[model samples]
Target: MANPPAVTVCLAGNVGRYKSSLPVGQLLLRGIMAGAYIAVGAALCTVAGTGVAPLLGAGFAKFIGGAVFPVGLIAIVLTGMELFTGDAMLGPLSVLQGKIGWGKVLNNWLWVYIGNLIGSLAYAYIMVWGPFTQGALGAAEPNAFGLNAVAIAVGKTLAYKSVGSIGLWSCFLAAIGCNFLVNVAIMLGITAKEFIGKFFGIWFPIMAFVATGFEHCVANMYFLPTGLWITQLFPSLVDKSTKAADGTVTYWSPLLHKFGGLTWGDVWLWNIIPATLGNIVGGMIFVGFVYYFAFRNEFPEDLMK
Candidate 1:
């Protein structure tokens, strides 16, 4: 998640030496699993993005990501894995609260890491290689008029400043701030003595996050660019010449490119990357240190082990 507080905490916790550490591979793997959790959430957002308007008024067409996406994220955070966004908080919180040992955090981090990579990669492949890949791909491309609309959709919402104007530090800060609220919601779920009340408590903030455009760093790993970036989503009828990175061949996906006209790469560069970084910054920094400093007085003994 590299959310808002991540960098600050990295600096802050490093002072007390309370931060968790692991091999580089494990750290990367944890990020991947966290990314997978995010990808699932993003996929839900993508569905909301495309189907909401047309399906409006239909109960089934309700925007799913703004509420349902966080439900799954809870499972990822609690069940185990190195969810980067939440991990930025949860792992540290566990240590500070005396709920779990740092070693256990590392274990959770490992599996989740691998799961995230598999998840993000698999989800991306499905969106790119599967039936809807072409249609999704076509939506993100620069139009025949040569404008990248998908990029605009994502960047506008994420940057909160300008298209192609937001800097790296800004994305980092904003993303972390957004996720800080997310972590608070999750903490409620984890701390509540009752499951029903927990669900009730957790639902509100998550919904708020989605409705208000508070970014979840992990979800960005999937939704922002993949929804608009890859060209394969445009289908083959219009452009048979485009090929994969290997440059071995070009093939039509499913939809006809002349119909919708989007691509993956266009979305990836303009929308996905920017938004991804934005989510990370928003969640990690903005949210991270706010809680850490606020609750520093409550630091427990068990986490010190």
Candidate 2:
């Protein structure tokens, strides 16, 4: 049997209430695991989608990547690991139920986000030195997987920066869309009473977010940094010369011009920073508050216990 909506909302709060009480160390450790799990999915998405576009067409290739990307979140949820994106909604919802304080919510967010970053970076290094690089341990050109990483990074950062402020807004909006669906996916997982039900519930929304081209900060923590690290190791991968309108040669992208080559500032400003804010709004306001009000008066009596 399926759980009722109110019961699901209450269960989410119960999770939030329980998680809020965990010590910093436990939260961080779970967060680390969650980040790595998410990166596992991100890496698979990048590798699987590598040459698929040429054979299956662009839209289908993206669909393939998106389809595989949900496995990370599935593993995280089933294993009971903490994800910052899900926490963004869960923490606030816990507070709304008067089950936890805002301070605890903030604390949870801070530690989980940091833990996720560390885990993502660690996995990024693994991919950079392992699957992304050549067989002789960085001796040869980056394989197709590495090339896809570079392409994903460039498109997220440089492509957005080229459009100016509008690009930032686009990133921000995309992030909002991402976390909104992410939390909905989380709620669906909670709504399910059976393992198989939870699995499918989580899979579809996550697949939709990635397939639809939404921005997710935690996943980006892996995706962007991995791309940056790989490019640093193989600068030639990004080098390219393009013809200018004046017929003069311009070095950019593959040529290494424009934004002066993917700085930390560009990474955060173009993608991460705005994406984080948008995620907060998406999860906190859209899912947290919306659900809180939806079931506020109808909360189960067991919740009072």
Candidate 3:
């Protein structure tokens, strides 16, 4: 059976408070695992979504990709790992409940965010040198999966930059939608009394967000780096001149060439930076504060202390 919303809110607050109290080392360790888990899902989504749009239909391919993307979060929740996005909500909520202070909340977020970045970079390297490659350090051409990685990175970064300020707003908005749904999934999981219930509860909202093409900061931690690694190893993929119908070779993705190729700068300015801001707003205000007030009157008296 499902848990009541009030019960779920209290449970979430307690969980957040307990997490805040954990040792920094423990938080970092768990955060690393959570980042890797989220990367696993991101990789799976990339592979599953590859060529799917062409073979099937755009909508169906999105469904397939989104369907597989929740495995990481499921593992994180069930196995007890610290993900930055979920904690973005949980930490502040604990602060508001008077169970933890602002310092603890910020401390937890800082360490976990660092750990997550390290883990994600590690996984991104593993992917670029292994599965995404053609069994060599450098290739004249990247394989389909590698190409897809590059494409994904480009779409997230350069594509947005091409449109200027409006594009930044678009990515920011997408990030907000993403974490809002992600926290909903987390809340639903908290509401479930059984594992299966939690599994399905978390699955649906996650799938919805990914299928809708929302930006997620943790997942991008993997996606962007992996793609950057791939392009570096195979620089040809970035600005290869291709034969045109008019018999002159021109660069692929005009804007990509115009931006002087994708850089770490573009990755942050175009996508991750704004996405991170949106994630905070989405999780902290949209989910964390909203739920706190929604069930404010119903919190356990002991918890109010």
Candidate 4:
């Protein structure tokens, strides 16, 4: 058996209340765990999707990445860790339900977001020195996975940088689409009564967002830095040139040539900041507000009490 719509909404708001009431230490700790868990999924997607595009085609590669990408979210949901994107919806919903104030919601978001960033950066550092590189940290060459990380980073940031404001708008739109699906998955997770049901409930929408090429801020926190670290460590890899028999340059990585390399500015300016703002709107307004209004009248009086 599953929760009815009204019951699920009430439960979600209650969960939000509980989350917002957590101590700062607990919030940060859980946030870190959630961030690492998400990074684990992102890493798996990267490794799993490697070399798949050319053989199975881009669509299949996307499907494969999407299919594996939900593992982190599943872990977070089941274990009760804090994720900023989910909190973006949950905290606001709690506020709407009068279970918490905006201040509490903001506090939760701030600490959780910081924790998520710290965890992501930590995991990215681990990945850079571990699987992504084959040798000692300082002298290592980026393995195939590392190269792919660089490419992924470049695509996420520089691709947007190339086009300026329109690119930022595009990223913002993609982020809204991302967190919208993410919170939909969160709602399904709450609605399901059984583990298997919850698993599939969360899986599909998360998969859809990733497969559809939407921008997710938390996921990008891991993706961008992993790529940036690789490129920064191996500066020569930033731009590769293919020379003809006559020693004339025939090919260069278009992104590397155009933008040079991923920078902190590019990562924040082009992707993360816009993506974060868009995620807030997507989750807080699209899912949180919409669902609360839809179900507010029907919530059991006992739930409110």
Candidate 5:
């Protein structure tokens, strides 16, 4: 994060002997910040799914959830923020090239992970408030992006593990492919520094992931919990003959009636945690660190020393 202690300078004793460190806490903080950025992007996409998306009706609504994840990730990369999944690649690279010790990668992973959860929760709060209070996006009488959005997310999430359990590595493979594009998206957005260049950079991966049905870790952060929140907050989003202090609270029961006994736990247990883990593994070990091994030649000579 702080330029990897400048391998050349440290190795040369330019500033006296120094050791490379991951400083677990710092990596965690970066992860948290990255997560918050991602959560915001998730909320934006949710709003788009409910109302007028930034890209307009051009993108598919369901894929809109997935699309927003990378869009948010690319922005974080462009902004030079850290993310766990992307870190997975970088962390390993650092270790393999001797830029940082193995201890650092583990520390970095722990921090980013905790931070990612905090960011995800923050996004959920904004999403519930957006449609509930302002009706900002011109949602339907029963907004799918509202209560229905969660339900659909729950269904989509389970499909992955259920398929995975049947020995379908499609989801696992998809996760890897998503990383290649995801990293590329970050590369373009972060380094390209042009709107269309960055946008087009993201466009190809975003489209490819959608077209090929790749698994994304961050989108699930918003989608799965948001679904549970929808189930939890369903009571809050109802229309009232008389508006009270608790319109959303009132809506939950009746929506359950309409949907036939939906439970919030189902979203959490069957969908959220598994999908979240899949996403984490996909981002960290699968995608992130793998690249580290592949690109050891790019490192500064100090690291080699």
Candidate 6:
């Protein structure tokens, strides 16, 4: 059965307290696992969605990608690993409930975010060398999935960079929408008592966020780097060309030329930074604070203990 609202909120606070109290090493280790798990889903999405846009419509392609992207969160929730976006809500909720202080909350965020980065980078490296490339890293061409990864990275960064400050705002807003759904998924996961219930509870909202093309900081941790590494390793792929029947060569990667190849600067400035900030607001304020205040008075005394 599902938990009542008050019970769920209290349970969330309890989970938050346990998370915040973990030592730095535990936080980092769990964070690394969570990051890699998220990358697993992202890799699956990239491979699954590749070339589907032409065969199916763009919408169906998106749905296919989104449909597979929840494996990471499902794994994380069931296994008790830490995710930064989820922590953005859970840690603050613990603070609101007087279960932990803001200092511990921020501490949890800091270590977990760093660990997530490390894990994502590790997975991205694995992808570039493993499935994304045709053979050895230096000599091999990027596979179809790798090429798609490049396109996705470009869309996330250059598409935003093209618009200046407004681009940052757009990324930020999209991130808000992303984590709002993410935490909603987290809440649903908490409310469910059965494994199958937890699975579907987390799946739908996560699928919604990805299909809608919202920004997610941790998932982007995987996506941006995978794209950036592929582009950097295969620089020729940046401005691809095709020979027509009449011997005319056309450049397909217009944005790549306009913005240059994906840079580390572009990754941070355009997507992760703003997305992280927006995720904070979306989770900490939008879901955590809203739900906490709504049920703070209703939490039973035993539940608080």
The prediction achieving the highest lDDT against the true structure is 6
The lDDT per prediction is 0.50, 0.88, 0.88, 0.91, 0.54, 0.93
> Per-residue lDDT for 14-74 in model 5, tens only?
1111211435565556666788787776666556556444446535665665555456766
Give lDDT tens digits, candidate 1, residues 158-193.
Answer: 333333455444554555556666766655655454
12: Cα error in model 5, Å: 21
Among residues 3 or more apart in sequence or in different chains, the pairs in candidate 4 whose N, CA or C atoms overlap within 3 Å are none
- Specify the poorest-scoring 10-residue window by lDDT in model 6: 134-143
Model 3 / residue 54 / CA error / Å? 1.3
TM-score of 5: 0.65
How much RMSD separates candidate 3 from the native structure? 1.5
262-294, model 2: which lDDT tens digit per residue? 667777999999999999999999999999998
What is the Å distance of residue 61 in model 4 from its true position? 0.8
Off by over 4 Å in 6: 136-140, 243-249
For each candidate in turn, the TM-score is 0.58, 0.94, 0.96, 0.97, 0.65, 0.97
1-305 per-residue lDDT for model 6 (tens digits):
99999999999999999999999999999999999999999999999999999999999999999999999999999999999999999999998898989999999999999999999889988998889996656764577899899889999999999989999999999999999999999999999999999999999999999999999999999999999988888888766778899999776677887776789999999999999999999999999999999999899889787
State the local distance difference test value for candidate 2. Answer: 0.88
Better of 2 and 6 by lDDT: 6
Q: Residue 36 of candidate 1: its Cα lDDT?
A: 68
RMSD of each: 10.2, 2.4, 1.5, 1.4, 8.4, 1.5
The alpha-carbon root-mean-square deviation between model 1 and the true structure, to one decimal in Å, is: 10.2
- On TM-score, the stronger of 1 and 4 is 4
